[model samples]
Target: MRCWCGKGNDTSVKTVGVCVRKDRVSPASSTGVLLNNAGFDYNVTRDRQSAIIMFCHQLNLSVMINANNPDDVLSGQNVTLDSRDIYLFSPYLVTNGRFSSLTDWQQKAVKCFNKTIELGIKVACQATSNSTIAATFNMTDLFSQAWYGTAMYNFDYFQATDIDLSGMTNVVYYFPNLNMNYGTTWQTPNVQTNALSTHYYRQTDTNTLHVFGDGLAYGNGTLTQP
Candidate 1:
């Protein structure tokens, strides 16, 4: 017998069927197999792997390295004894030839799709900024574009690793009133000249953080002065 996925039976497992539990679809839905392991927990496969990997990635946020690599894992090379990484990764391993969940494949798909879209947007934004540059300045497109906007003064600083902002712009001008962590204590840096306007900023907002640049946001298409 064939499955709804249109694939012939496994021929090896006589009782297996297709699963359609509102999860685990495929790029080409027509060719995707929805195997039913009957009494399996899908989370044991997909969610646990992604969550653990993400947790490890987060714990090593300061190190700028991936901990799951076997070289870093098995050989003990490039491995830091980050207990957080160990605690996060160890529990997901298969025990006694069994796992607790099988829904991992769906979460894996979600992660892959999300990362692709995130990277594509960053590349597009950087490219758009580059195409607008005058070429003679020998400066980066991100820096030049910000200067031409209503930044007014050097209200920000951008290193490959961090960014510091000064002055007031609408996006952050309301920071002090937001009732958030930095609410009452927020203050714009006192910048001296307009020279700082030449720096490019990648600031994070409530939705996304520019992990590539100090977890800041890349302001929505450049906030302008009214």
Candidate 2:
């Protein structure tokens, strides 16, 4: 008098040829086991199962128990989540995570990328400027190359004096218009025959003049033609 319990058998109605087992079935071995029984080949690891479940729950995705290859559908979703994590944690990605819209994220990404590129270029230029080839060029040329074709001049008097412009051709001087209330006397060279005297004078004021040996004067006062 052996009996069988068919899947479609109703417990309330006793059938002639079918019987029901009264003992309870144990729980599934693991999450993997449950997923496997539901026709998915998910890896039988606790962490992997937990990660997949949590990720799906966060995105409001349904974990269909009876679907074929349920884990395969999550492959792209997992990749997307990984990409987002990379962008969020990257050192170069500057963001407040408060995107008003999708276009806002796009604009921020472009700006960050441009800034990163500019920084890289500046670093590279600085390194190149320290090389031997840069030594052959003047400070102005090196500065122009490093700063993307912008010329930089030293405005300090000492720094300007340190630069040797003797080899440079076509030197020009600019002087501002000045008004002198009194006229000054020029020193006459000695009338020695066959002897040359080179004297340079810088006029500091309308009443005083300092003379040097062959150096141009920079002053703000008027000078009479020699």
Q: Pick the TM-score winner.
A: 1
* lDDT minimum window of 10 residues, candidate 2: 150-159
Highest lDDT: give the candidate number: 2
Residues 141-190 of candidate 1 have per-residue lDDT tens digits of 23322222212121122111001111122122111111122122212322
| lDDT for position 103 in model 1 | 28
Query: Scored by CA lDDT, what does every candidate get?
Result: 0.22, 0.23
For every model shown, what is its TM-score relative to the native structure? 0.15, 0.13
List where candidate 1 sits over 4 angstroms from the true fold. 1-62, 66-139, 144-222
Q: Model 2, range 1-226, lDDT digits (tens) per residue?
A: 1222222212232231122112221223211111222112432233333344344334433232221232332232232221111111011111111112222222333332333333221101111211122232323322222121100110011101112221233332221212234234423321111122222222222432221121122111122333
